[model samples]
Target: MLNVFTPNRHANNVLEIKPEELKERNIKGIITDLDNTLVAWDEPDAPEEIIEWFRKMGEAGIEIVIASNNNENRVKLFSEPLDKSFIHSARKPLALAFQKARKGMGLKKEEIIVVGDQLLTDVLGGNLAGYYTVLVTPIVETDGFWTRINRKIENLIKKRLKRKGKI
Candidate 1:
């Protein structure tokens, strides 16, 4: 099962990749997971570090759109303050959510990158959607049990990838 998947290309959890870097990869847009990927699970606003990252990516001309499974209230609460574009009720790992986010960004699956912290949801969802995936370590350590289980599985795959020098 692990052999059937592809983890993100970047090593760091910060996912501080700039627009130029994305452009080189031919990535015109981004579909990101909001909670643990960009902020702590319940953080209300973007931190300074996050704001800078957003500004940098924006200056690079990359459009940012969030694809999260969070509810409308949670999603809007997280996004409206940052004034960023995003989709709530993403239902990730399901290609439909990723597709919706991509469409909203005015980009195609091939040209968009999905950035998130989880393997089963974010990476799998992005892979299923046929977009390039970037996995980052979670910003906080508050994930649920099910998510924790998936991480363990992901770690095993990562270890194998490392042994083969594929990560």
Candidate 2:
């Protein structure tokens, strides 16, 4: 139902999600989307701010794993330099990739949070997998070809959710 697409929390961007708040919530790990969720879809790498965010999370002893639908090369390239774990070609909106990321983190479902920009992929997938989900606004308003299609559908869903005041 619509609840599956609704996030438990929302933030303007990933940087707005503070480590202190997460720690207070007892969330020890993050399963995050890569492209527009963390940076522009076309961005080749993480920018300084994103890097610093990762550093903060690390300093707080919070583990992070990137789960991206993009190819291995793209995900690996972005993740390796950050020295973070990743799952590529993740096929989001499916539970398998989320499960893989959770298992890799070795964190219980209650100890993890899923962060992403898209509801169809990120929120739905995370909710279905029984994890707390945070929907951060995409770093850029623009999206890649396939994501644009999802965005259109997401807009419609958002409107409905708004009418119901569930978002």
Global lDDT of each model? Answer: 0.79, 0.94
The Cα RMSD of model 2 versus the native structure comes to 0.8
Worst 10 residues of 2 by lDDT: 36-45
Candidate 1's C-alpha runs over 4 A off are: 152-165
**How much is 36 displaced in model 2, in angstroms?**
0.8
Screening candidate 1 with a backbone cut-off below 3 angstroms (N, C-alpha, C), the clashing residue pairs are 13-137
lDDT of 1 by residue, 36-152 (tens): 888887677778888787888888888889877878998898788878888888778888888777778788777888888887788888887787888887888877566777778
On lDDT, the candidate that comes out on top is 2
Write down the lDDT that model 2 would get: 0.94
Score candidate 1 by TM-score against the native.
Answer: 0.86
